[model samples]
Target: MRQPRPRPRLLPLTPRRLPLTAALAALGGLAGCISGDGGTPPDTAPPAVHLQQPAEGQELAQPALQVVGFIRDDRGVQRAEYSLNGGPPQPVALTPNPDGSRSFGFQAALAEGANRLRVVAYDAAGNAGAAERRVTYRPPPPLPAAVEIDPSAFAGGWWDRYGPTYDSNPALADHGVSHTHLYGNDAGYVEYAFTLDRPPGTALATLRARLSSNFPGWSGPADGESDVTVYLNGKEQGTRRVMADNGSGGEYRFALAPADFVAGRNVLRLEVKSGSAKKNGLAIYYRALLPGFVDTPISIAFSAQPLPSFTLEPLYAPGAAAFAIAQGADALYYFKINRQNGFDVPAQNFESTGFTGSILGTDLNRVKVTFRKDLSSGDRLAVVVQAGPQAPLGEHAFWAEGRGGGVGSSPAAVNLRVVACSSGCR
Candidate 1:
């Protein structure tokens, strides 16, 4: 609504006689109104600004910023300007809106970390107003150089009782490391286990193993002894006749699609059918492990994207234990030595060494064991039992590695009793 404006006054005149004084007074008043000395004050308030782009607290991946919004004011808006982090202000492209509002847009560079974005609107009277937004920029995680694993590291995991033992053979080459190979006079089955954690996304998983096989030069089909069949988690991955090359073995690599694997673990097996059980004549599927099989783990690799976080869980949980051993964790195991009457037993990890750690019996024997993560040695864990007269007479124990690595056996067994007697003892 507009304020009313003052109008010029008119002159007064007599009906019969002319009054000079009255006429003069009326003329003076009319001149004063016509001169117009008083009026409304010039617009002094700043232009109002509305920013519509780069919403507050937005996370961005790139370094370029697009700013957009409009200017509004009772008086005409003169210009729109923007600044990055309070640096010098620069004019932006302003276009007139149909509703008489002025719109603007511009692109600016964004540096890493927090950026203070300010947009200001100015009126022709030089009055100004502004709106501000604080934005942030973060870079994505880097891709891994490569992901590789070893299968031979888990050789001797489990083997069928009917066949020759599946063990690592050293001195195969100059490396001085052991390779799991088939080299017995009879035929049977040997199994190898492998596992993986949850991958970031779909990945092309591959396994490359050094393999070779040999037979005792039996009288049957001379060439049948060297062919080998392969299986992944019991599913056939197809058979490949590994050339013995006089038993020197060569490197073999293959790809496994994403669907061939689960979120956590997978197992691969190689079977050789060389010395059949017939004795007089048989293609032992080692002609005993499936005919002739040899495996030397080189390296296994998978392509994966970056994941924010992932937790590793074991696939097999076959046997049950007494206390801490009853439950398994990534880095530790837990159990209760003596059950507290009417109360739940708390599970826990070993404190380097101690007794009264109430773990009884053995079931960890069912777990597939590997050498130390750094691939050091295979020494089994020693279970120490501390007993007393007040405690139960006899307690058994189950064990699994609280740590990871190659399989090893316990150095010695424990069954000692520390009987505590008091003055009031019966």
Candidate 2:
């Protein structure tokens, strides 16, 4: 909250040092005014105090709390003081910062459980104004163990996946062209090699490669070619050419025919050749999708996995809203927000399937929605809502189909809204 500055107060004038005749006249006038039908003085308004920090019933992790507030009055603030619980109060000095805001902070340890913090302001004449808040203090949680990774320490055929790519760290010799592997200038090709722990009877199913483009604002087109060859038991089984898009990067998917895959220790290699490249990044990971056959030796790391189900509830306002399902698995609930078009806002992300139980002791099982920002009392805003894993990999899309509307408009406005589902959808 923002507040206006207070105005200054006026002082009363005092009568002193007069001649005997003037003094006698003034005394007589005062007596007459008191004795005549003089009405009682009007009651004075009390000074007000306002608090701004550590809102009521807040939980804190630190022992020392910073108290922030301001004073309001018919006249300007003269002085301020703070107190904890019912302890003796101390005066607080107000200092203005460069931003034109006045602030004061104090350090004091709070006891466990509920603690009361108070602030009082005083005017020039010693009139008092005060406000306070009740907060709960709790200790902080322990830190987790540290983990480190070394680029050079990585071994096996998978090393190539982490090396330079067309969009990533491109070859300096090639005039910033994207390339895989950073062999010395004399060498022309980069090798991506990885070792696989294949089970004896486990034949290869699909060989998946995961890679990425450049970060920051250095995104553009790159002409590159890659050849992937798979080996089983020290023998070459099959090979395929990697796919490429005109501008965007994509994962390369290769499905093996039965004869192309064999059981036991496997090796995969990728040789990439670049024509023209920019400042881009690349990464590669192989995934072996096997069903029911639990005993596999090779461990595949892929980012595109289905996410768990969850629930959402709106807090603070009412209305019907629609969430645009851009990607990933999601579950949505419908609630009435306004009578017009049945106002419903999308709820926060949840990882649970059933909203049957209470949350934080509140019955939030219903599709309760909360706005990221405040909305006007009568204004209805269209919001695009989504909850899922980050982009490009995971699979899932949800929208009210047919009854709500087509994919273009809100379900209420369009006819036959279509919900599309892709791979890795559960």
Candidate 3:
């Protein structure tokens, strides 16, 4: 390679010096312009905020919310506050750090829909720094249609010594033990585990229980009373004091909230207190009832007025039979007509297969007829049965098969005795 053009002689570099006045000015600028008295400068900049919780655009299910974050400044942070949905400011809890920073925390109740959350922090110099976030809150979904936990579903449970004994058979000693009946002077509880399709909210549920007591068949001088406490999972639901004064073993109903139940498996507990009876304390046999799919007759009466459930009397009707039926929920019920003894349903009065106008069929006890709409909310319907001229006159029994909302209830027995009409029948 050609002589790299005589390399310029390398020389050692030397630092450049500035005037005394210029040096002092540069130092003052770095110090943020110290006061004339040589004191620290005021903090003009606001606090720097870093939100750590409820990130922006977050969606929440519950109204109760907890906010957390940190704030920093060159100077020490003084205080902090937060506001939700443009509401009044609320104080925040601050934790101090060695580096002139503060960690803040607070709680806020969010409204139903979109919520605006703003957190502001102040430094010793009264400078404020703010951070804002938008979050949306939604309410929980509704409860399922219905649920029913039978007696056999409950297995053995724990027994606590008295304050509330978790007993297995609280009513085993009543002498005629059937179902989960509880009676005695010792306080005890029984828990039933059940599964739900959805979370139990505030929807209405019922507890069908019989509260009655006697001194082993009329031995005690006075009727006894028992106190019972109901619980869903671990939460207290309600309490009741049932009296053993009714001889018929009257059923008492207790209203329950679905919210006490969870989606999957859940526990229902009944805590009974010791009573002051010679032999029995509080005799209670309870069953947990949830509104699901029910298809059964709540009540049936021959007259226009509604009657109590399971009410029956000797039936003697001529030509036609008229009655009323009541159900607990809305449904479409199918009535099955059956012959009693050797009676036969008139072949001319019903269809064999397809139900065209109201779905009527006849085949002795195998006949199915009467598709009627049943209203819920404790409503009843009137049903009239007219025997054809060719039909035999005797006793008959019928039942209703209810179906609605993709679910069904067991059929209920409704019996009737048809007498011959002197003037002939339809």
* Top-scoring candidate (TM-score): 1
Better of 1 and 3 by lDDT: 3
Q: How displaced is residue 288 in candidate 2, in Å?
A: 31
Relative to the true structure, how large is the alpha-carbon lDDT of every model? 0.46, 0.38, 0.49
Between candidates 2 and 3, which one is better according to lDDT? 3
The CA lDDT at 178 in model 1 is 32
For model 2, how does the per-residue alpha-carbon lDDT over 335-425 read when each residue is reduced to its tens digit? 2233333333232221121211111111222322234433223433222223432222111122221111111111221111112322211
- Candidate 2 has what TM-score? 0.27
Steric clashes per prediction: 43, 35, 11
Highest-scoring model, lDDT: 3
lDDT of 1 by residue, 1-426 (tens): 999999987545554245776677778767776775444467889987776556688666556776766777887788888999989999877766534567666778888889989998888889999999888876543322333434324354322223343343343333422333443332333455655565323444565655544333323333333445556667766555554432334666665544565445666655654443222111111111222444334455666422111111212123422122213322221111221123221122222323221222111222222222121112222223322112222232222223211111111112222122222111
Candidate 3's C-alpha runs over 4 A off are 1-42, 145-426
Angstrom error at residue 54, model 3: 1.6
Which has the better TM-score: candidate 1, or candidate 3?
1
lDDT of 3 by residue, 258-366 (tens): 5566778877776664442222344444332223312221110111111112212232324344432222211122223322223222223222222111111121222
